[model samples]
Target: MAPPELHPAVLQSVALTVRPTSGAPLALQTKVLDLEPQPDGSTTLVVAPPPGLDPREHHFDATLAWTYPLGRMECTVRTRPGRRAYGDVWLVCANAPATRLQERAYFRARLTVPVLLTWTEATEETEETEETEEQPEPVELHGVVVDLSEGGLLATVPSRPPALGTRVEATVRVDGENLTQPATVVRHVAFASGGHGVAVAFAEPRRHGDRLRAVVFAVERRRRSRT
Candidate 1:
């Protein structure tokens, strides 16, 4: 059977793995900014590049994975530097067709709760800071959890979202228990309600993976039972 055609709407978020000529594979979660259709029926994906990686530096063998309605899908493609689209975003052309992958390990459940995010922003080095050796203070932002899963959760904040690949500590209360996990900023999205949504992947998912799975499963069961 021929591979299915992927639509841009369905390709909201994706996990990108890029292998450099010399170095460890860089894995990141990012959102698709735009899609360009080609004459040969292929599509070029404009996406957020991993932090500190210059697309102009080298070519890469990349694997793109995303969750589809039926299941998860992925494809391998060769990527070369394309024109810079906007701030911190670049284009990568997928030169191959996608293949179906196994079903997702965990289903995301809609859950609304309060979340506290803590992260630090880089500051310019100064003479005083160099002498003191003090680190920058961590900034705290409060948001609401829109969905939950074993892998990560989506939350929205009033202010501009943090930069991608930032390490953050997220704390959420579930069932009277406060769960804190170290997570990475994966993607940023805007909502119609005038706030920004940030998607974060748990850096140490195994620490609270079981608890999150249980909560998600319970939510799923309750929703199904009502219908």
Candidate 2:
């Protein structure tokens, strides 16, 4: 699930490894249900086989290559039309899987490559006063990254949730292999994991800012999970 603020594109992909173990009269079809983006920049995708496809009649399957970063994605498929289904998913690189990896066959080692790119673009800044946190830590981890379309990103964590008037530094990671920078923290919200979501605005994004931004995007992408 995603908050209303995060709107992401719907990535489409196919699910291979399905054999006529199914007798489905008609061929199987696949589509991406939706993609959910979180405030942290991570994303989750939902998919399933098309309706009107019979389950017992045919063992149907297909593989899908969705939008960039999420290349070579696969899942076990089943469709009950108006009911629910369970799928086994495996994330692989576009060049991976010389042959479609089978589902449930109890295979050897498998690799799941992430489509998330490590975008760098960050700035450097510091926060002296302890404004926010469930329990303030001595040091804070923060950074900034450019969004997919020149969109900017800000990330920060404070010792505790600060009052609305508090001001702090923001950090941006530089792009092109270099990383790290400085910025300002604007607001803080207490997160469930004893972390605060510190809203920030960078003072200067040029000069290695892009590198940090790219790294943060990579970090954010790694945090995404399919609950």
Backbone clashes per model, in order? Answer: 0, 59
lDDT of 2 at 1: 26
- Minimal lDDT window, size 10, model 2: 108-117
User: What are the lDDT figures for the candidates, one per model?
Assistant: 0.72, 0.33
Stretches off by above 4 angstroms in model 2 are: 1-158, 161-167, 172-182, 213-227
Tens-place lDDT per residue, model 1, 1-227, is 22125533324878888887778988877777777767876667777666677856544578888764334668876555556636656566665666655465656777788888999886566323775577777899998887677778878788987798989999988988989999999877544334577878888878998998899889979989999
RMSD in Å for candidate 1, one decimal?
11.4
User: What's each prediction's TM-score?
Assistant: 0.55, 0.25
Query: Compared to the true structure, candidate 1 yields what TM-score?
Result: 0.55
Using lDDT as the measure, the top candidate is: 1
